[model samples]
Target: MRIAILDVDYRSNVARAACVTAPSWATELPLATHVSDIESVQEYEPGAFYKRELPCLLRVLEQLAAKPDVIVIDGYVWLDGACRPGLGAHLYQALGNATPVVGVAKTAFHGAETCPAVVQVRRGTSARPLFVTAVGVDLAEAAGWVRGMAGLHRIPSLLAAVDQLSRSTFETPPGASAANAVAG
Candidate 1:
């Protein structure tokens, strides 16, 4: 199976999205996985997951019950106005090709020119850029897959749902405790 997984922080809840694909079938997500990076909200502050991403990602990777052929991660956060993390380079460094991984974002990052081809999506009549990377799957192949499935929208179906879900997850309070990130 050609599987792709998406991991992102939502209200400090680490939301995961998975899609399994084959020659004839494609399966996407069992809803989402919500994870918290800190052991307690009293110890860490809200939005800590997005701020301290390495710890957050460690928790997220642990929460993944099933492995995917490729994992796509969100890649942007700032320590200061001028010091933002490189989502693509960081994810690549973290994974080290041990497993295929890619970073996704709406905005462009510095050094993005070195990455794979970026998707120029124009669903029907609108023209806009979409995603970038050639981490696990080929860029053209991945783009074709999204173009076939993204429907009449600027964003792909899976990513659009994730974006909305992440925004909505923040509406609810993340509560009092953190997740035990140790692998089971």
Candidate 2:
């Protein structure tokens, strides 16, 4: 299955969102990548976390050459046992529930530990776990896919690559000043 991993990063007033697409079996590298930027993003709201990130994410998704079988977001699918919508859930809904979404969170959510849809995944002997949640797919199966992602660290290789790609857009190349650098 083709899985697209999504992540967003912000630098000043600019928000950069990136998607890395790869087949589930080939986790070593991304088959394709898309990036989108939004200027003057809405100020961060305390509770509504997806508000600022969603627009840019949607833009990146729109730029993809083809739709992915599933999307893996860098956060929770559900906030609590009540199945409160998180970023991944919102993305799933935005797509009209056409595609499955799996959330891979680096930190634990307060009540997620007990949620049947949430699984704690530990990679490469690390004691810390990445909380995995899913919509439209079995949580255990999602966790298995996450566990199989190529990596020796807490974050999967492709996910890490996506994060790096998002942040790199904001980075200034050596000898170039930030003022002259244009972020895409």
Candidate 3:
């Protein structure tokens, strides 16, 4: 199966989205990478974080050469048991609910323990656990996959790569940074 991991970073008025894809069997390195920059991005708003991120993510996904079976985001799918939607959830719906989404968050969300679709995962011997949530996949199964991702630290290797790729936009010519780059 092909899986894609996505992350976004904002600097000044630009928002950059980075996506890295690899076969599930080959987790050590990404098979392909894509990044897009959205200029004049909306300013951050208190309770509406998804508003800015969702569009940026969609723009990045639109530039993908192929669609992945599952897309992973750097946040929670649901904030509470009541199913409050986060960026991942909105992305899942915006994609017409065809592709499954998994969210991996570095920090715990308040009241997240009450959510049946949320799971806490610990990698290595670190006391801190990652908060994982999913849409269109079982929570335990998603967590298990995360546990298998390449990494010796708390964050998986590919995820960290994507994060770096997103932030590296600042070093590249306005929109030409990741267009010719492939991780594998």
Highest-scoring model, TM-score? 3
The digit string of per-residue lDDT tens for model 3 on 98-174 reads: 99999999987777766676888898778888899999888888999998888888888899989998887354555
- Provide the overall lDDT of each model, using Cα atoms, as 2-decimal numbers: 0.44, 0.82, 0.84
Tell me which of candidates 2 and 3 scores higher on lDDT.
3
Global Cα RMSD, each model: 7.0, 4.4, 2.2
The 10-residue segment with the lowest total lDDT in model 2: 175-184
TM-score of each: 0.57, 0.89, 0.91
lDDT of 1 by residue, 36-86 (tens): 433332223544444345544545455555655555555432222233434
| Candidate 3 structure, TM-score to reference | 0.91
lDDT of 2 by residue, 40-150 (tens): 577889778888887778878887768889999999888888888888898899999999999999988777778876899999889999999999988898899999899
Q: Which stretches of candidate 1 lie over 4 Å from their true place?
A: 2-4, 7-34, 37-51, 75-85, 109-117, 170-175, 178-184
Better by TM-score, candidate 3 or 1: 3
Least well predicted 10-residue stretch by lDDT in candidate 1:
16-25
Which regions in candidate 3 have their CA more than 4 angstroms from the true location? 171-183
lDDT of 1 at 55: 47
In model 2, which runs have C-alpha deviations exceeding 4 angstroms?
171-184
